[model samples]
Every structure is written in C-alpha cells, then in structure tokens.
Target: MDVRKRKTILFLGMALFAMFFGAGNLLLPAYLGYQTKIDWTSTFTGFSLTAILAPVLAIFAVAVSGNYFTDLGARANLKFAYLLAFVNVLCIGPLIALPRSGASVFEVAIQPILPDAQPVWVCVLFFGAVMTASFSLNWITGILGKIFGPILLMFLAILIIPGLFIGATVDLPPTIIEDRFYVGFHEGYQTMDVLAGLIFAVLLISGANRKGYTHINDKIEVVVKAAIFSAVCMLLVYGGLFYLGAHVSADPTEITRSSLLVHIATQYSGVNGIYLISILMILACLTTAIALTAGAANFFERLTNGKLGYIEGVITVTLISTLLAIVGVDGIIEYAAALLNFIYPVTLVLILSVLLFGKTIQNQKPYFITLIVTMLISFIRVLVNWFPNEEVFSAILNVLPLARFNLEWVLPAILTFVITCFALGRNLNLKRNQPF
Candidate 1:
C-alpha cells in the first residue's frame, strides 16, 4: 500500500471505530464506573476484557480467516448465512441499536432541559431527521469518512475532558465489589463486545478492500492496523466510563440494559453537557448503523450468488431493519440474541477451522469434527435454557448433567480448538492458506 492508501485505510479505519462506539459504548463504561463507586479500576477490568478483547478478537478472526457472512458459513448452507446476517443486522443496525442510540442521545442531551410541560418528540423529531440525513448520504464509507474521520477524536475528547475534570474535584471512595478484577471481567462480558466484534470484522474487511490493496496479505495487514486503531479507542473510552461509573451514584435503577451513561453524565455535566454528548452520540451511532447496513448487504450479495448489488441489497435490508425497529428495541434485541446464540458456536468453530485448514479441509477431518463437537456444547446450553423449570425433571437433569449457568460452552470451544490443533499436528500435510 502507498502512503495515500495507508492514510486512507487509517482514516476509514478510525471512522469505522467511531461508528460502533454508540449508546452501549458510552453509557456502559460510565455506569460500570458508577457502580464500582470507588472501585472503578476493578470494574473496568471486566469492561475491558469483554468490551475490548471480544471486539478485537472478532475482527482478527475475520481478518485471519478472510471470511464474512457467506464465507463464515461456507461449511454450512446458504440458508444459515442469510439467517446469521439478518440476526446480526438486527443486533447492530436500526432495529435495536439505532433507535436506542437516538433515544439515549435524547435522554442524556435533550430531555432534561425542556420545560416540564414541553412535548418530548423534540428529541424523536431530531433523530428522525438524523435517519433522513444518513439515508441520503452516498456510499456509507464516504459518509463515515467525511463525518467520523475528522470528528472522532474530538468527540472522544469531549466525553473524557469532563470526566477527568470532575474526577479531580471529588474525593475517590473505597472499593465496591469484593473482587474488582473478576467483577470487571464479568461485567465486561455484559457489553457483548465479543459478539459485536465478530459482526464488525466484515466492515473492517470491506473497508480495507475499498482502499484497493491487491494482495490479501497487504489487505490483512491494513485490516490489523485499522482494527488496532479501533480497539485502542474502545479501550480508552471504556476505561474512562468505568472510572466515571465509579464516581456518581444517583440512580442504580437508571442503569438498566439501556440508558446507563445518560443517567450518569446527566448527574455530573448538567444540561449543557447533555446536549454536547447527544450530538456526539448521534454521529457515532449513525456511522455504526450505516456501516452495519452495508455489511449485511455485502453479506447477502455474496450469499445470493450476486443476485443483488450493494445498493439494492442495502435498501432491502434497511426496509426490513426499519420495520423490525418499529416493533421496538427490547423485542428486537431479544430476537437477535436468541438467534445469535444458536449460530455463534458454529460460527466460532468455523472461524477456527478456516484458520487451521483453509488449504486442506480434505486432509483435516478433525477440523470439520471440531465444529460439530463445539456446536454440541453450545446446543446443550440452548437446550438447558429451553426448559424454565429443571426441577420438573430432576431425574432427567441428574442423568443428563449440566452446568448451572450453562456456560460449559466455553470449555468445549476451547477444547475443540486445542483438540483440533493436536489433530492438525498429526496431519502435518494440512494446507495453510494466505491471509485474504
């Protein structure tokens, strides 16, 4: 890649980073910080691992394997790819995330300042305008490059500047959780960064390709650097929010699945702060929502034998996504998560399989076997959860054997990866493919 190209990659890369750093990214860290009160450091550990590592690994998985929706599901059927793509869009795009982004931005920035008797649709009307503006933009990359490219660092600074100034003014308190590190780690998982990371990998790959690197290796190198830029920003923001979370304690109830940051930032920054944060939040969310639409479109285009081009595919997806969003954020999230949990174990297994044997699926049966084994573990999790009352079948539960949390899936995924590695060692003739 030339200097101009490298600079282009980095610019788009950073913009992509800003896109996904929306409501969850902003509020969760601050809420986690607030929950820890004085134990922000400990809680942040949880936040970083889940929010940071998961997303990074996910992007790396895509780069390492060179797989997106269809490629990721190549081992499976095309139907699975379509399903996976649809569910992923719901999770990140307009359905669950976009409206929530608009809502959270308004709650933090707009709602507090209006006269008590004033209508609330001012914020809703504002976000509706945002949707229109985002739709009118040309290729998403163009929109992001223009909006996020220049503004990302400045917006990040906005959130952090206030937090730092406020932190110095107040005295730090003692720890909240008994084990801050573990608490932080567990809390980190709640952000679902790992899941988002997997989804973002497609965007990273596509964005890298748009810069026109002919070689897969060069393209991957670009992907890695861009992802690093994204991951680093996420880490800093999460850490700040975690520290912010530790500082204030106005309403624990405010920090539900949504609206965590709005509650906290509102407590400290006053009405002016809210307005600034809302604008920043809208920009970040818009970038992410547009990118997600593009990704889903790219995935579908590939999966359907090029039946639809990117533009047409995006329209189809956006229409469906907007309809789903109308059902509301809570429902959409539940629907996406339920489907994702089923697909992800298989998806994770396939990613490792591609890494292990992109060159010789013929030689490595165990890599193929690993998918089944890991999926069985994930399946058990689903099955256990399927039944609300295990006590109804005590004998059956005792006979089948299960973890209380159904988290045994983690062990099997690890075991499959390790076992497949051993198998690959036995079959040294297995082919190794290059990064594209």
Candidate 2:
C-alpha cells in the first residue's frame, strides 16, 4: 500500500480499537485475571475467542454480505431484518451499552477523585460532550483515531507497565474458579464486543469507503488488515491487565472490577496512578459513547426513512442514555446481562449461518426455522435463570448439550438449520424432476 493508504488503514485500525475498548473491556479482563490466577493462559484463550475473535469475524461477516442489515436479515426476511437491526441498535446504543459507558466513567473514574459527585451531573457533562462530538459523524474516525486513541493508549501503558512489574514482586493466591476456561468464556459475554461488532462494522466500512477504498476486494482487505491491527492492540492491553490482576497480592474477591483496577494502579504509583486511570477511563468511555451514538443515529435516520434526522437521533439517544446512566452503573449492568442473554445467541446464529452457508440459505424456510429455534432455546435458558427453582423448565433444558456452559442454543440451531436445508433441498429436486 502507498503511504496515504497505509496511514488511513492505521488510523481506522486505531479507531476500531478505541471503539471496542470501553469500560466492560477493561473491567472484565482484570477481574478474570484476578479469578484465574495460575490458569491465566487457558482462561485468557477462551476469553479472547468470544471477546476478540468472534467480534472480528462478525465484522467480516458483514463485509462479505455488503450491507449489514441486508446480509444479516437475508435468511429471516425484511421485517426480521428491521427488527434485528432495531434491537441491535437499542442494546448497543441508548438502552444498555451507552449508559454503561457513562456510568463506568462515574463509578470508576469520577467517584475515586470526587466521592460526593452527583451521577446525574456527571452524565450530563459527559454525554453533553459526547453529543457534540457525535454530530460530526464524518469526523469520528479522525477524531477518535488521531486524538483520543493515542491518548487512551498512552494512559493505559502508563497504568499497565508499572503495575505488571510491581505486581511480579508479590506472590499471588490460588485460582478461585476450578474451570477457568469456562468461567472466562462466560464472563467474556459481558464485554458484548461481538454484538457491537454487528453495528460498528457499518461505521468501519463507511470510514474505509470515505478514505477511497471503493472496490469490494479492497474494502474487504482493508477491513481485515485493520481488524488484525486492532486485535493485536486489544490482546496486549488485555494481557497486561490480566497479568496485573493475577499478580495482585491482596484479596481479589474483596474488590469490585473498578476498585481492583484502581487499587492496582494506586499500589504501583500511589496517587498519580489513580489519576492516570481516571483519565484513561473517561477517554475510553467517551470515545465509545461517541461511536455508539453516531452508529445509532445513522441507523435510526435510515430506519425512519429520513423522518428522524441524524442530529435529532443523537439528541434523543443522548438524553435517554444520560437518564439511564443516572440509574448507576451496577443497575445498568444487571439489566444488560438479562437482555444480552436473549439477543446474543440469535445474533451468533445469524452471523455463523451467513458465514457458513453464504447466500444459499437465504430462502425463508431454512433461515427462519433456524433462527426461531435458536431464539426459543435461548429464551428457555433465560427463563431458567429467572426462575431457578422451576424444576420442569430447568430439567427440560438441562438435557441439551452445553446447557451448563450457557450455550444451550448451539446444537438446536445447527440441527434446525441442517434439517430445514435437507427438507428444502429435497422439495426443490422433486419439483425440478416432476413431469409437467
């Protein structure tokens, strides 16, 4: 690639990295490190599968299909496509992820320095800036990549490098969870990067096109290269945080995710490191907030057929998310977990089906059957969580493979797809050979 192209790719990669590396991204790995102890290697491998690999693949899935909604919605039909897009927007936008970002800034960054700070005002000021930056959607890649991305990386390095070295001197405790890999895999869901990938892919593809990558092959190549670069950056930072969390000499169970991060920072560099982490959290959260707001606004503007303008979408999302953020980070987190359980499995099925079957399975019969089955199975899983004591439901669901692993939908989805495809294929053959 030429120098200009190379520069565009690098900046796009950085912007993607910043968008993915939000509060949940930072907190989950650190807490996993604390829990995994000596089994950090296997645990992190499992964590990386869901947190990094699945998300990157989701981006590729969208790229291959050419349009995010059209490709994703191909199998299920137009109405399903719109509904899925709408839910994806809400889950990753104002309803859950966006509010969590602001709440995280307050709980992890602001609360440490100003213990008495009002969350409502914090969200107001924070999202006020987010709203302003989000209005310039064309500039998101440049703003995040050229400016905030670098600063976020620098602060993370400052916090991580010293913590890793300092932590090495302290002997750590035994692993808390016996099944480290499984625990890490399950915990990785909380990051929600895979779901975000479906929406964020649109932004990345648009950014690449604006940078003059017009050819389909060129866009695919650029997205792949940029995703690789972003993945490498994420691995390094997540690895460093995990190392810090694993090596902390203090009682890991006693501390919350944000508190543990702050504790480690303060331990390594006293008060200065605390301030550094605070800045890091704010920037990380702010950049992601901007990206989510922009993505949602763009999608809504299109969804409403221009009735809802981009600026209006931003304003509406900002106001809603700001109010939700005031509900506090923990509450947002609790609610998000429930919603993710419902949506994520269906999304996974959609992405994987597209990648595996391509356009061949776009016929409504097979597509809808597979997704409906997956959703039904996943709903049962969620119901089990809601009513743990309901023996009838729990016992019925337990027979499915990986039910204990929170992956009860996998087998059912695959089986449904295969059976539907076979039935559809035989019908087509019979019709073709029959005498008119």
Candidate 3:
C-alpha cells in the first residue's frame, strides 16, 4: 500500500474509535458521579477499566487475530465464532445499542440547542435527516473521514481538557463508606462498553484492513498503539467528567437527568460551558451513529454473504434504527447494560478462553461446546426475565448463588467451559491412539 493509503487506513481506524465513542459515552461517566456520590473516584476507576481499557485492548486483539472477529470464536470451533459474530452485529445494531445512539444524541444534545420558538419536532426532523445522511454516507467514506473525523478529535480535546482542569478546582467527593471498591467495581458494569468493545473493535480492524497491510504483526502493532491512544483519551475524559460532576454536585441536592454533565457544566461554568459540551457531544454522537449504522449494514451484508450489498443494506438498517430511536425506550442505558450483564460475562469468558487455549484447541468442538453452554445459561436467564410467572422458582435466583444478583450465569458458564474443554481434550487425545 502507498504511504498515503496506510495513513488513510489509520485515519479510518481512528474514526472507528471515535464513532464508538459517542453521546452515550459522554453521559455515562457524569451520571456515575451523581449516583456514586462522594464515592465517585472509585466508581469512575472501576467503570473506566471496562468502559475504556477493555474496548481498547479488544480492538488490538482482533487486529492481531485476523479480519474476521468470528475467527476467535472459531479457533475453538465454527459454532462459537459464528454465534459471537452474529450476536456482536445484533448488539451493535438496532436490536440494542445502535438505536440508542440517535435517541440519546437527540435527547441529550440536539433538542437542547433548539430555541423556544422552534417546536420539538424540528429537532426530531433534524435528527431524522442525520439518519438519512448517514445512510447516504455509504458512498462517501472520505467525506466522513475529512469532516466528522477532525471534528471528533478536536471536540474530544475540548471536552477532555476542561474536565482535567476541573480537577484542580475540586477534589473527588470522598468515599462515603467502606466497600467503596466493590461499589466502584459494579459501577463499571453499568458502562457495558466492554460488551460494545467485543463487537465494535471489529469495526476498527476493518478500517485497518482497508489499508492492505494484512500482516498480523503489523496489524497488531497499529491496533495496539491506536487503542492505547484512544484509551488514554477516553480515561482522561471520563475521569474528568466524573470528578467535575462531583465538584458541581456539591449542593448535595440536585436533579439528576441523563445529561447530568451538561447540567453540571451549565451550573458551574455557565452558558458557554453548556453550549461547548453540547455541541461536542452532538458531533460525537453523530459520528458514532453513522458508524454504527454503517457497521451494522456491512456486517449484515457479510453475514448474508452480500445479500443486501452496501447501498441497500445501509438504507434499510439506518432507516429502521432511526425510526427506533425516534420511538425511544425508557431507561435505555440501564436496559442496555442489564442486557450486557447476561451476555457479557459469557462473552468475556469466551474471549478469555480463546486467549488462554488459542493454540491448544485448534478444533472447533471445544469452542463450540463452551460457547453453546454459556449461551444456554444466558438465554435461560433471558427467558426467566421474560416470563417470570412461568418459572416456579424464578423469583428466588438469590438462593442459587450468582443468580440472586443476576450474575449466576458467570460462574456456571466458566465451569462448564472448563469441564467441556477438558472433556473434549481428553476425548481428542483418546481418539489419537494414546491410551492413558
């Protein structure tokens, strides 16, 4: 590839990172401060690990693994790889996180910018137009590369700098009690970016592959470095947002909205701060929404083996997501995170299992068994939540260990994966004529 081509690839990779970092990204940390209260520091740190570090690492991991993220799942078997890839596409699609981008961006940033004379529908129309434009973006990757690309980086700089500066002006609200660490650790679960990371990092890898440096090591280096760059920026911005929120929320009593940071900025830094943050957030969300639509369309096309193609798939998916965003759901972020608590622990273990036994389990059977078992547990939980009245003991997950806290699936999933892997391994060895 030409030098410029490589640069473009890296640029697209960066854009992928930016797109994953959206309006939802801006709001989660600030709300963390408001809810965690004086214990905001620990909460922020715990959240950052999943919210920032996990996604960043996953981006590089896929780059090194290969073009298909499903390949990781396939390392153990084709079944797992297929399921993971499919789930990731859906998670990043309208089934969950993607629609939330437009809904959130519109609710948190765009609508706020309108004047008293302008009706709320005007904001809705504008947001709808964004969805249209994003669909059309299938034909103009460069336009996005040039415009929203720089806008994202510049705004991130602006958003992060003010946040870091807020640190000097205010100390974190002190931890309110013992076990702040545990609270902080669980708070990280709310971000669910790790769940998003397992999916979206594939987008980052695609951008890198477009530049044509297919060598795994080279891709690994670029992915790792870029993830690091992006992670550091994310960490600073999120931490600042949380600490700054602590500063602004010193009143001990303030209404907590989804857009708490904007509210806090307006309260502390006045009108300019509010406008600045809002614009940045809107732009960030716009870029992110575009990427999610584009990515889903692309993934759908791929899964169907080019059934929809670029233009058709983009239009159809984007339209659906836009419409979904318009209708909106209540407590969307919380719902999305809760959705993650079910799948993510299993996904996390699957991702880790590959890293652990990548070479040892070249056959798909072990991966397939582990992934299927995990999904079985997760899906069972999903069904239980769906029809609580159907299950006799559904109300008593607490008696069953991790189930009480809604995390029962994790330990069992892990246990099943290990047992199955060993059983599979032992069977494979026996079939190899080695009688132990």
Candidate 4:
C-alpha cells in the first residue's frame, strides 16, 4: 500500500476501535478485573476471547463474504436474512446499546460532575451531538478517526497508565468467583462487540471504498488490517482497565461498575482523574452512539430501498433511542442480557457456519435447521432467566451439557448443522446418480 493508503487504513482502524470501545467495553472489563482479582490472567483471557477475538473474527467474516447480509443469509433465505439483520441492528442500535451509551454518559460523566443535573437534558444534549455528527456518513471516519478517536485514546492513556501503577499500591482481596474463566466469558457477552462488529463492518468497508479501495481484494485486505489494529487497541485498553479494577483497594461488590471505574481513576490521579474519566466516558459513549446511529439509519434506508431516507431513519432511531435511554443504563442492561442470550448464539453459529462451510452449505436446509434449532434452545434459555423460579424449567435446562454456562444451544446447533449437511450431501449424490 502507498503511504496515503496506509494512512487511511490506520485512521480507519482507529475509527473502528472507537466505535466498538463503548460503555460496556469500558465498564465490564474493569468490573471483571475487580471480581477476578488475583485470577486476572485466566479471566482476562476468557474475556478477550469473546470480547476482542470474536469481534475481530466477525469483521473478517463480513469482509470475506463480500456482502454482509447476503453472504450470511445465503443458507437461510431473504426473509431470515432481513429478520436477523433487523434484530441485530435494533439490539446494537436504539433498543439497547444506543441507549446504554446515553445512560452511561449520565451515570459516569454528568452525574459525577453535576450531581443534580437531569439525565433527560444530558441525554438530549448528548444525542443532539450524536445526530449532528452522524448526519454525514461520508465524514464519519475522518471525524471519529482524526478527532474524537485521539481524544478518547489520550484520555484512556492518562487514566490507564497511572491507574495501573497506582492500583498496584492498594492490596486487593481474593477472586470473587471460583470459575474465573467462565465468569469472564459470560461477562464478555455484555460488551456486545461481536454483534456491533457485524453491523460496523459495513461502515468500515464503506470507508475503505470511499478511500479508493475499489477492488475486492483491496477492500478485504484493508478491512482485515484495520480490524487487526483495532483489536490490538482494544486489548491494551481492556487489559489496563481489568488490571485497575482488580487491584483497587475498595470492595467490588459494594460499588457499581461505573463508580468502581471512577473510583479507580480518582485513587490514581486524584480529582483530576475523575474529570479525565468523565470526559473519557462521554466521548467514548458518544463515538459509539454516532456509529450505531449511522449504522441503523443506513441499514434501514437500504432495507426500505430508500422509501425511508437516511435522514428519516436517523430521526426515528434518535427518538427511540433517546426515549429508551430514559430507562437508564441498568434497566437497558438487564433487558439486553436476556435478549442477547437468545440472539447471540444464533449469530455466532451463523458466523461460524459461513466461515467454516463457505459455499458448500449454501442450500437452505442447513442454515434453516441450524438457526431454528439454536433459536429454540436459546429461547428456552431466555425463559429460564425470565422465570428463574420455575422448577420444571430449571430441571429441564440443567440436563443440557453447558446449561449452567448459558451455552446450552451450542451442541444442538452444531449437531443440527452437521446432520443437515450430511443429509443434503446424500440427496445431492442420489440426484447425480439418477438418469435425469
């Protein structure tokens, strides 16, 4: 790549990093660090697997497939493609992630600085900025990469460098959870980066094209390179935050995730640290909010074949997300966890199937069977969360291999896919042998 092309790729990577490094990305790792404490290595490993690695792989999967929805939707049919795309967009957009970004700003930034400030006003102003920034999708990479991305990184560096060193000063307690790896893996889901990665891949690819990467190979190479860079940045931030959370002298159970992060900052750098962290949270959340808003609007505009224009889509998303954000971060998180439990497995299976099988399993049977089975199992898992008290539901779920780990759907999905593939192959063979 030429110097100009390399520079564009670098910034694009930074832009992608900013988009994925949002509220949950900031808060969850730190809390995991605090909870895991002395067992930080194992826990962080598991956390990075889903949180960092999965998202990176997702970006590559989208790049390799050429079309985001079409490639993944090949086996499932158009309706399934549209449906899954819609749900994924909604989950990462207005319904959950978007609002969580706003709520996080309130809890971490506004609440700390202006104790009596109304969150409604904060959300209004915050989203107003998001709307304005997102209005021109063409400029998103430049805006996020050239400006906010650096500010976000600088703030993180200030916090992480000192926080890590200072955190070591305060001796911390034992690991709160016995199964550190499991806890880390499960907690990683809360970041939702993998889901965001799928949506954001479109945006990233668009950025590459606008930067004059017209060839398919060129686009894939740029996206993959940028994704690798983004992953490295995330790993550093997450590891630093996890370390800070683990070594903090305060009791993890006693403090909220947001509070614990702020507390860690204050401990390391005094009141100045609070301000840095506050700005960090606002900018971090704002960057993600902008990316998601743009992604949702773009997807809807295409979904409607421009019947709903981009501006109209933005207005609709902003309104819904702003309204939902009023429920606050905790509320959004509570509901998101349940929804993700149901949808995430299907998404993972889809990504994996596409990556592993390529064009071989493009026939609808395998995709339909795999997705339907996964959804069925996942839906039951959601119900278990909804009705934790029902003994019968608990007993039935307990019989599954990884039910306790909330991964009860994995085996069923794999088995269904393999069987469907085998059956399809046999049918193809029979058809070939017949005189037709």
Error of 3 at 354 (Å): 0.9
Please give, for residues 154-205, the per-residue lDDT of candidate 2 as tens digits. 8889988987778877776667677778777877788888888887888899
Clashes of 3: 5
Indicate the TM-score of model 2.
0.95
In candidate 4, stretches whose alpha carbon ends up further than 4 angstroms from where it belongs are 426-436
Of the pair 1 and 4, which is ahead by lDDT?
4
Q: Model 3, 89-119: lDDT tens per residue?
A: 6666666665676666566665567534232
Please write out the lDDT profile of model 4 over residues 1-436, one tens digit for every residue. 6998789889999999999999999999988888788889889999998899989888888888774654555546667877888999999999999999999999998898889999899999999989888899888888888898888988899889977666777776676587788778878888988889988999999999998897999999999999999999999999999998888878646798889888988888887877987889998999999999998999999889999999888889998988988898888899998999887888888888878775554466677789999988888888888998888888888888888777788888888988887877755222111111
What's the alpha carbon RMSD for model 1?
A: 4.6
For model 3 the TM-score comes to 0.82
User: Candidate 2 clashing pairs?
Assistant: none
Per-candidate clashes, comma-separated: 11, 0, 5, 0
For model 1, what is the alpha-carbon lDDT of residue 291? 60
Candidate 3 lDDT for residue 105: 59
User: What tens digits encode model 1's per-residue C-alpha lDDT throughout 1-436?
Assistant: 5787678667766765766676667656776676667767766765576567656666766676555644454443444445655665555555556555555544554545543522235434544444454443235666666666458667667767677767656776675556666566644543445556666676666666766764788777877777777778777777776766666556555455345555555666775665666666666656666666566566556656788876676676555544444444345444545444555556556655565555555343455556567666655555545664665433333443333333345566667656766766756454433213
Q: Which is better, 2 or 3, measured by lDDT?
A: 2
lDDT of 4: 0.85
